[model samples]
Target: MQKDIELSGKLGKKRGNTKSKDCKTKTLILGCVVEKPATVGEIFKRTGFTGTYKSLAGMIRTYHDYGYLYRSGNKPFTYTISELGLEHLENPRLAREALIERRQANAVAVTRRFLLGMDEESRNNFLTEMGIQPVEQHVTIAKNEPAKPDKVTVKVLPEPVEKAKNEIKTNTRTEYVSRPEDLELIRELEEMLASVKEENENMARELAGRTIAKAENSTKKPPKVRNYDELLIRCKDTVVGSSFFNEVPYNLYVVIAELTKASMKELLKEKLDDVLGKKDFKKGRIVLVSDVQASALLRYKFVRKLKEEEYEKIKPKVEFRSDGVYIVVDRLHFADRMCDLPQIQRKSTPIIHHS
Candidate 1:
């Protein structure tokens, strides 16, 4: 008998847990849109929600009817939680209790209707299964109250059945009654759902066309080689000069100086006599004083390993400015190595200023 009691306790606890989860359905739906507006698809993708899309959409529509959610566009309508919805999320006890009460009342109404539609024998069997004594037994027990105790063995209705009866008595509440405005909102929601369906079909066609185009382009073009070391060697060998003076560009030293935390002038201060050495430029510098000065004018980041697609099309190019000469490389390269920079905000400098 103790084992039976334990088993029943476990079953009852499982049922209660399920009931608790069911009561929080509205609260879960409202929580999904508390941070930002989201379509049903986006909410599922972001939250890893496992419910059916149609069921979620229906709940959102109901919340909108209650003014707990705001619906934005018609194309796959996005939902945002309203201020009232936020209030409900923070203190959901009252709302959850009311929902559970309404559900219980609705369940009783449905069961009563089903019993009324059944034959007498079927109705008796249904009530017996639910542990409810038939209506005839109630009459019999009242009549036999003064008789022997053995005759009063007919069981009384269980607690759930008694509760169901009380709920049915108070089931006249009209909280879910549809007003004219609600009907209008329902029509609009239906229209928006239909529009979303049409848009999805169009997007499918567009995606198929793009896939075919991509395949054809892939067949026409051969993939380019992307060797980081080879590119680095070529970039290092890049020389920039006029007929009057030809030499390796000074911009490379500027990049090395920036990496080593030394200024361009400091790096070249010892090497002045090597090429455009200091003797030629008044200072013992190999290049012009103007060129050395130009290198330190503007702050910029150096590009390292390029992404495959960028490597295929982009070649190293030198850009000249009044203040400095710098190399322009693929954006992805700079993005990949940006973390190495001491100040991350200096990742990229905007070349153009718009007023």
Candidate 2:
């Protein structure tokens, strides 16, 4: 049984345990490495690993082989996270969620293997214990075989005999007495049943209360929309003289215009640079005309993938207009604010328009 349990990766062993291969162990190992490079002994102690020293060493070797860890030092080998491992640990929430999913899948697989190893009766009992009903096999009988009696019936007695039997039964019923122990047992059983019923009722009430609370939470109104103008002002102030402003690609403006309902002609006519050059623009004066443009800009400039921290930093600066378009009120203003016009000091040159 111990061997089987160990093979099944369900053993409660202190050393050389199969749990070292589990997602939780892997996560712990990565977390420890992220904190600082450590030797095998340090990692095991920090992570509270129950596996043998030899096993821990082997696991570290495996991690190094998989490009998740890099080994350093000779006498007392130290381990550090590789670039790939750092990427995995970059988002702790995603890593933890993935670990949870892996654990659930492993649990299901283990349960299936355990059930498959059990005998028929034991399997049935296991299913019943888990609140599941086992399927029963239907048996067929041959047409030539004699039918088995499920019940037995006796013929009626003669009238005189029947009358005497009825009189005896009536006398017995009239003189029947209940034993003290039997009565006490009946009372106890009734009390137990009542208690069970009350418990069930309490559980039902609790379940109902939770359901109602969940519904209320689901139906609650969303957070109030933030003022776009204020957000634009903040962005303009923060980014105007920042290094990130200079890094903004010139092609992004063309891309934004191409993605929006407004044409390049309209943008040029408005003197795009001048309109955004003003620092005292009124609140709600500028509206976004294209969601595609905003999304494209965000994807190109900020993050192409979902990361909560980066997303939050850029989210406040953009808004989705009711007209199904996304707009950045400060796009032109911020860009214009970044220009060092006085520093140029050169004669005005003819601007070349590239088609």
Candidate 3:
């Protein structure tokens, strides 16, 4: 049956797209998958005008034409990664060393030429665009030769200077009750500059506080407005752990963003576990979880549009917000879903979605 063959081919490509590839192809695939979908033609363009890229594109196109790469419902007609493509990825490339050298040299060139002029965020964006990332970010403190700490001296009071003491007794606390004429005559100018300085400082502080408050209030958006479930799903796929282990069947992400959007503080109900065999995972959405913290998390997902079975596809049990959420994940994996509401619940508070 042509239809069956086509379906199998499409399934195979999908498997490849999801699973295996050479370094460059993986990078290109990841670039497309995380941010947006792409076609074989687009991938060839990204590889630059090279024979290797054209050859690869030709192969991919052939595969697609053969129905090995089927497009999903309203999704782009993209080729999935196939077992054969995956096998190629595991092979050692003859130009591996040369490619590494070129990449390193190019990185240096970028840092010296373009990156120097860019701001921090722009530089990071550039790195991402280039399919590279900064090795590490660090701040160095200028260590001047160590200075000795300040020394404090105690004054022995110079034996209380008997003459000074007597003079103080005589000169101190002049009891001139109601000497208005003397006070008037003794006037020298006393500047009110200190009081003026204090008033200015107070004014500046008040103005700054008001400005910050206004900005914070205006910028914050309501967490209740967006679909929290979709947010979690997006966060999960892209969130590879600090280290990724495919042997582990669970889709463990380094960060869980549902917590950020769901401020359901009353209950912590996001609990998930891989109890069933990975094959049985499809039918068993109800999981027995070990993490009690996840149980206390609130449920915050907008699945009104999703079919009931589709909703159960993800075992999104977690302790949202309260704890056990990953703080950093690859940015491309987590698409920036913006909040459209003008003003959020009064302040920029973090939401810990539990259920």
Candidate 4:
């Protein structure tokens, strides 16, 4: 009775295992087809199935025959899930469980090669870190085998020491130290500033002294008054307006000589007409005098007539003098004749007497 119970239990377990394997294979095929219509080769490759290609092709044909999947294309047959297959997967709870199992299986497969390349201890430690349990069978195999040298070695520093070394290097690079050369540069700059300050002060003092000296000199005496008679005598014998009035329309010299001989006040156009006894002579002379000789004759006449007190006031006003008509003449023409006449020099030198 005990032997029969044990035998029945073993058979039941074998049947249960076979059922689970069939169910997993069907689920993988359904998942691949539901995701996209694919050929037997694509489905097998994507699902990472361990079955032979021929077996997978046979399984795909079987599914199409059972109406669980439908053929979408021919040459190389492509299969997609049918309504019956979709209805089986429509159970939300079962679908979610299947998806989670598929993800876990993929993760295991992806890391399996890397884990196998590691030694037993390292493999266990890596699996532990990844929250996975290392297989006991793998551990037993590792124990039976001789230890092999590691293919790759990695160096890892403690966190605090690595951080401290980085900080020390950064601080050393950033820290600044003053040298003797810098001190020397600063000292030289200070000396230069001091010398510049001294030079500026000396220049300011010298300028101030010069300003005071000029003020004192200005107050001590006025400018020496020029002798107008001496000025006229120096310019005597030179023709008035000779440089600019080279070709006179009339006999300008004759008119000038007549004015000097008369010893009259400077002649206006009307006075010139009266003295020369002809209106035409006055009109012709006007062109010559107005063009070049007006300003010079006016200046001479102004000085000749100015009194001591009047000279000071009118000297500044002479440049702006507007209300006068004077006959232009060469002073040198009269100088020799006037030297013999005491009255003409006496009339011209009033400012000299006052000074």
Candidate 5:
């Protein structure tokens, strides 16, 4: 019950909304060239990645875009972990923060797209549903219409008005008198109370039954990932929201698969079966991710495929220092989602790291 309340509050909080795809992969990628700069092919060979060379190259390029891996201007560029990337590799929290920031920015982009597509009433309704206060519009009076006086004012009151005011001031407040109760009225009240009691008893029994059912179905083990391609794509193929983009990190796919599983439906409070079609799932599979995981994933996916103009509106504000180093200010409204810690800037004077 407490967890459900926390989830409710988390969903309701209004927020103004990446980095490496996954922590382990990020660590591996960055770790590949910590000692020395290496070409993409060299890094690929070093990591012994099973995925295609093109995917590995793409991932490296994404890291470069985010200022994690810096490469040379020459052809067949050599990739090296930047100062920022080194710091991130050292502290897993930094990577988590970057991932969270990416998710938040994506959320902002997704929200903008959704709200822009909606009419004023529907947009306002959506905002209300998400617990965000809609922007209040000022009332404008028509130029041709006469303005009404806010209050009545008179230097000398009319006779009728003055008489009415006098009566109001002089009048005493009325008091209520109780009537003698009839037997029918007494019997009716008793019957109403009995009906209410019966309803309460029924509600209590229903609640107790639900509680027992939940307990019986609860499990302590973490959720196992099912092969989505085999289960969802090949068997029960249904395009729900957007086309399946394989570019999103493997870890995110695992999370989505785990959360959307039929076994997790009751725990996560979402039934993908309605949209994704029902499958016979094992009873009592433990759900590892929170209810908001799916929402975050959706937002991330949405922002990734945004139109150029739509993307520009919510993109991070990138500013450069005098030395040409860039700083990314995401400007997320929520405090928890934003990285509050001071970023250590690269010094103009370089210090050599002795091995």
Candidate 6:
């Protein structure tokens, strides 16, 4: 019941001349992700309906494009609302109202996918760096809510139960008294919110020059590599500029397999997958050279592939970085034993040994 009320507010906000049945249906979907992000299958079942998965997915896609929602990778349960969406539930801000307006407008706009096509935080921070703060937002649920009325009454005429039942069955309409005073207050509140937006724009408008200067001035710390396990998780099949390459021997595929606990084919595929696009990754089989030899530009190719994939299912990206390189992707790892590469930059770097 409480959820229905919240959904009603979202739906009401989206109602406008361009309203569509699909948009209203989506307003009702906040309950699902608000509780926890759900897969397409779960959302359809949660709604207790069939034949609308595509529509729901499409709406989810649109929201994701706007950053009100997002998608996970290499697994199920892809859709999720951003923290901004949750905040929008509590604060009826301009961004939130704009999403509602856009939903209503159905004017068909294009939304950019996340930066480097990564998770929401990485993507958002990247956007913030670009000086294009994400504007898409949506209301989730507020801690405060209208108290439930103690009672509800239905006025009935002095008619027999049979007659009253028959009359209701036939459906007679009842008109409520018009309250222009209340309506006028709603108008004033709307105008006040708009005025506040105009004032804010005048105060803090950022130009492209400032945006570029800020980016140039910003210090993006070299992403510190965490524990081997964490890095392994993030870069499962993905590559980075700091991986092992040109370190493997042709005859040691078996030994390499044992160290990584993977088959020779799995290891080879991992290397190629790290180096190529979907097309290249799909064609995973490749010849092995005696030593791993891959290039920085190839590593860049792998990074751009992630950008292009954009929320599509991708294996956890994995790279081997030592003092030698900063983002060593498997695509850059030519041989099975590429992980054996010696330190080229710093002498104090530890080997990949876990107790």
TM-score of each: 0.25, 0.22, 0.16, 0.22, 0.25, 0.28
Q: What digit string (tens of lDDT, one per residue) describes model 6 on residues 189-280?
A: 44655565554455446556678877897885222221232433444356432132211111111111121324324444434343222222
Q: What is the overall TM-score of model 6 with all chains considered together? A: 0.28
> Regarding lDDT, does 4 or 6 come out ahead?
4
**Candidate 5: residue pairs that collide:** none
Best candidate per TM-score, number? 6
Candidate 4 minimal-lDDT segment of 10 residues: 334-343
User: What lDDT would each prediction earn against the true structure?
Assistant: 0.44, 0.45, 0.35, 0.43, 0.44, 0.39
Query: Tens digit of lDDT per residue, candidate 5, span 191-288?
Result: 65556456556867999998898788777422222222122222121222112223111111122233344444443343233322322222222111
Model 3's lDDT to the true fold?
A: 0.35
Q: What would the per-residue lDDT of candidate 2 be over residues 144-238, giving only the tens digit for each residue?
A: 33333421222233357756685442332111223445446545644655564565568679999999988989977333221222333334423
Which runs of model 3 end up more than 4 angstroms from their true locations?
A: 1-37, 51-58, 65-70, 73-76, 91-355
Give candidate 4's whole-model lDDT: 0.43
- In the order shown, the candidates' Cα RMSDs to the true structure are 24.2, 23.2, 29.8, 52.8, 30.1, 24.3
Ranking by TM-score: 6, 5, 1, 2, 4, 3
Q: Between 3 and 6, whose TM-score is larger?
A: 6
Worst 10 residues of 1 by lDDT: 335-344
- What tens-digit string does per-residue lDDT give for candidate 1 at 14-92? 4555545443665666777776556665554444445565666666678788877766433345567777888877766
- Compute the lDDT of residue 183 as modeled in candidate 6: 45
Taking all chains together, the TM-score of candidate 5 against the true structure is: 0.25
Which ranges of candidate 6 are over 4 A from the true structure? Answer: 1-23, 49-51, 75-77, 90-204, 207-355
Candidates 3 and 5 compared by TM-score, better number:
5
